[model samples]
Structures are given as structure tokens and as C-alpha cells.
Target: MAKLTVERLKKQFGTSIAVDELTLEVAQGEMVALLGPSGCGKTTTLRMIAGFVAPTSGRMLLGGNDITRVPPHVRETGLVFQSYALFPHMTVAENVGFGLEMRGVSRAQRGPLIAEALGLVRLSHLADRFPKQMSGGQQQRVALARALAISPKLFLLDEPLSNLDAKLRAEVRTEIRSLQQRLGLTTLIVTHDREEALTMADRLVVMEGGRVRQVGSARELYEEPRDAFVAEFVGRCNLLPATREDDERVRTRGGLLLSSRRRADESSSASTLAIRPERIAIEPGHHAEIKGQLEAVTYLGAHTEYQVLLGESERVVVTRPTPVRDDPMLSVRTNDPVSLTWDTEAPRLIPETAKD
Candidate 1:
């Protein structure tokens, strides 16, 4: 396993930029995910690292060696495509040994490598099956095995589970994470699914508008988002337009004062206060720090979500574990007035002009 480093990487298409000065490092044997919505440059960055796309500027290093100009096949990086990219004419074993063949490995030496790779993904029994004969999950595993067979220094997965059904995605993601950890593979995954990144990665890089917004562990990004974008992207958050009134106080646009953990920056013109839905507690009566009318209640098996209307237009959402049948909240109806409260540290102040 080796560390991967990208420094001030930039890419431009004609006049539009696809990736802008992106810098990140993946530690040896650590799994990191590039997480963001479409066209946010996550895919472009991955392609650049894989050598499929050339960077407009900057450099990349793998294991302390400069690989900025290396060709894709010679880079010694194993990449699994989003589409699986398996050839229909080949069986699983043939697919797994293709990279080795291209690298001039003799057929006599390829059998054990192919078998080991298939075994790692629990697909050794399907070595003779063609791509068309397998399910999506199986095909994805074959693609993974094909990548793994090379035993490259860096492993890359581009939306590896996107093509699978929801249940299959869940199962396969768990399998892939387990395999990556067991092998101590230095891996990087690109995905738009927040849950996938949060659950599978040691750290996450959130991107927007072809630039990185924040990069940290799941807990850090969820609990201490640097701005409104990171706060809302990593999880569900209620972001209120706020103005600094004091070091630890801010007045919302709706005229509600809220306590925050972050001290107000004197030079900033505005701040956005972020509160996670799960952190806010809903009270039965209108007697807490803020009062609101219940607009809706949604029961989601293990948890329930409540949408509350504060003032005339501000809306806040609260999430809690589903209550028992006899719980008082079960009796509350839409339009019922309710109060909301949270610990003083629950709200995070986001500067209007925060940078990555």
C-alpha cells in the first residue's frame, strides 16, 4: 500500500473549468471517498488520477514518486469503472487476467493470481461464467476482481455500487469495504451517495462547482461543517440566515435569537446558523426558546421526522426515534403549537464567505 498525493490539481475544458486547484492526500492503507453531486468535479478528478484525463496544471505523487506524466496502463493503479466495463466476450477468469496479459505476464503465472482475485471477492466458482450470464452485483464483483488481480499500488472505484439495486448496493458496499480493510489497500472511491461515503470511508472530500468545499472524517464534516454548503450537503440541516449580535449569539432573519458554539466574526456581514435535524428536541407546549406550529409528521420505521413552522416562514425539522403508541407526541397533530430546544453547542455558525 502507498500514499496518494494531489497538489493544486486543475483541469479546464475549452474555457470552463472542471476541477479547480484541488489538493488532497490519501494516507497509506486508508480509504477515502470523493463525495458530491453530479458535475461537481469528483468524477473528473478521479479520471485525472487514473490517467484517463490529463490535468491542465499541477502534479500528483504516489509513494513519493512523481507520476504526473505516467500513462494509465503503466501507472500501477487499479481502477474499477462505474459501468463495470467488463467485456461480453470474456469469462470472469479471462477478465481478471486481462491486465496481467497486457503487462506481458505469462499464462502459466496468471492462473493463481486470477483465482486469488476471484476468491477475494467470493466469485471463484463463477470463473467460467460470461458477463451476460451474471447478475449486476456479480458483474461488479468481477470488475473489482479484475482491478484487484493487478495488485496495484493504488485502488480506485468510481461509483462501484451505483448500478446495483438498493439492497444489493448495501450488501456489496459492505463487502467492498471489508475487502479493502482486510487487504490494507490504499483506496479512493468516488460517489454521490452521502450514506455510502459516510459509512465506508475513513474520510470524505465534499466538492461543489468544480472545487472542494471541505475534507474530513464523517463526524467532522457532519458536526463541524465549515459553511452552509458543507452543512446541507453532508446531511439534512436547517440553515437559518443570521446576523451576529454578540460573540456567541445570533439573530435569525425571522427575529429569533439562537445560541451558537462558534464566536461571531466581527468582520463578517452575515452568518448562516446550521442545526442538524436529529439534534433539535421537539416539546409538547410552546414554552421553549422557540415556538412553532407542527406542519407535518413522517414516521420512518426506526425514526420520525417533524416539520415545524417557526414565525411566519422559517421552517425547522426535528428527528427523533419513533415513539411508542402511548407517547404524547403520537397524539400531536398538524397545526399543533410546539416548542423546540437544543444544547447551546448544537448550532454551528457558518461564515458567509468560508473557503475550503
Candidate 2:
């Protein structure tokens, strides 16, 4: 296992800056994810670490050794791409052993190691099958085994499961996490899938437009995002513009006064308040509730999402448990009168200018 450190890492393409002085660290035996949308420079950062894309300016270190100039072949890092990248004509055992063979491992030493690697991914039984004869999930496992066969110091996965179907993706993610934990390998994964990053990473680094937005655990980013962009991007939220008052409170444009722990004295006369849909409650005929008309209802398997229009300009989203009957009491339809309420402590206040 190795600790990976990136210092002021940067990459540029012509006039556009891909990665802008990004710095982060991955502790030994820890799993860290570089998460963001396309063209956010996450994949470019991964490529830099793998020596696939040379950084315009930066330094990469592994276990206190400066390897910024190391070539890909001598980096001792394992990489798995989204497209399995396995040789179609090569058998599973042969594919797994290819890396070992390239390093000139004798046949006697390569065979057992290949078998062990396949067994680690639970593909020992299919060792003789070619890549063409295997399912997408199976092919991915072979690719993983090939990476592990060489016993690399670090493991890098660039959207490794993006090609698999939903069910297979989930299953394979679990397997990969389990395998990494057992091997105690330090791993870095780059992905745009929010749930996958939240589920698999010990810590998440959210990037935007070539800069680091926020770096924290899944729950931290979900509950206490630093700004409106991070809040909206990491999860579902309802943004309501409001004004900062003297008593540590914010009054929304719709005449709703919300109490919060944040003092908005430094903020301008206008600010934005964010709340998660799950935090909002649909109370029936409550006088203290903010009045709204149900605009739409979406029945998700575990919960029902309601788009509530408050007053003339304010809108809030609320999610509640799905009803039991076809038409339950909470089965509010479009244009139906409803009240939206939530705990004041749940609201996150952001300066209007901080909003993206």
C-alpha cells in the first residue's frame, strides 16, 4: 500500500485550463474518489497520476518518493479503465497473467499467481474462457484480476463500472470494495455517479470547473454542503431566497421567517436558503405551515416526491413515504392546497452572491 499526494496539480489544453492547482492526498490503504461532471478535470488528474497525461505543472508523490517524471511502465501503479480493455482472444488466466508475463515472470511462478488473482475476483472457474465468452461483469473482473496480478503499489479506477448495467454495477462495486479492503490497497476512483462515489469512497473530493469545490465524507457533503452549487450537485435540495434579519433569522420573499444557527450579518440584504426534500413535511391543515399548491407528484418506489408551489414565487419540494392505497390521505394532486413545514435547523443559508 502507498500514500498518494498531489501538490498544486495542474493541466492545460490550449487556452483552457483542465485542472487548476488542485491539491489532495490519499492516505495509505484508504479509498478516495475524485467526483464531478464531465470536463471537470477528474479524469485528467487520474491520468496524471498514472503517467498517461503529463501535468503542465505539479508534483506527484508515492510514499515520500517523487515520481512526477516517472514513466507509466515504471510507476508500479495498476489502472482499470471503464472499457474492460481485455484482449478478446486471450483466456482469462492468460489475460490475468499478461502483466506478470510482461515483467518476465517464469511460467512456473505466473500460473499459481494467476489462479490466485482470478480467485480473488471469484473468476477462477472461468479461467480458461476467453473475453468473448464472458459477460460484461465477468470481463471487468478479469481486468481487475489483471491489475492485481502484478501486485501494484496503488490501484486507479477511472469509472471502472460505468459500462455495466445497474444491477451488475451495484454487485461489482460491492465486490471491488470488498476486495480492496481485504488487500488493504490504496485506491483512487474517478466517477460522475453520485451514489457510486458516496457508497464506495471513504472520502469524496467534489470538483467543478477545474477547482476543488468541497472535500468531505458522503454524509458531510450531503448534510452540510459549503455552498449552493455543492448542495445542488451532491444531492436534491430546495433553494429559497431570503433576507438576513437581526435576530439570527432569515425571512424569505414568501413571508416565511426561518431560524438558523448561521448568522447572516455579513451577507447582503438577500441570501438563499437550501433544504433537502426529505426534510420538508406535508402537514394537513396546519396554520403555521407555509401555504402552497401541489404542482406534481412522482411516485418513487420507497417515497413519493411532491413539488409544492408556495405563494406566487416560492416553490419547495417535499418527499414522503409512499401511500399504501391507490388514493391515500396524503395523495395530494395537482393544484391541491397543502402546507409545507420543516425544522429550521435543517436549512442551510448561503449568500446570494455565493449561488451559482
Best by lDDT: 1
TM-score winner: 1
Writing each residue's lDDT as its tens digit, candidate 1 over 1-356 gives 79999999999999999999999999999999999999999999999999999999999999999888999878999999999999999999999999999988999999999999999999999999999999999999999999999988999999998899999999999999999999999999999999999999999999988898989999999998888888898999998998777766788898888776555543364478889999999977788878899999999999999999999889999999998978878888999999998988888778655653
In order, what is each prediction's RMSD in angstroms? 1.6, 2.5
Identify the runs in model 1 with alpha carbons over 4 angstroms from their true place. Answer: 264-270
Reference-based lDDT, residue 113, model 2 = 99
**Going through the candidates in order, what is the number of backbone clashes in each?**
0, 0
Candidate 1: pairs in clash = none
Off by over 4 Å in 2: 253-256, 263-270, 325-331, 351-356
Alpha carbon deviation, residue 1, candidate 2 (Å): 0.9
In terms of lDDT, the poorest run of 10 residues in model 2 is 261-270
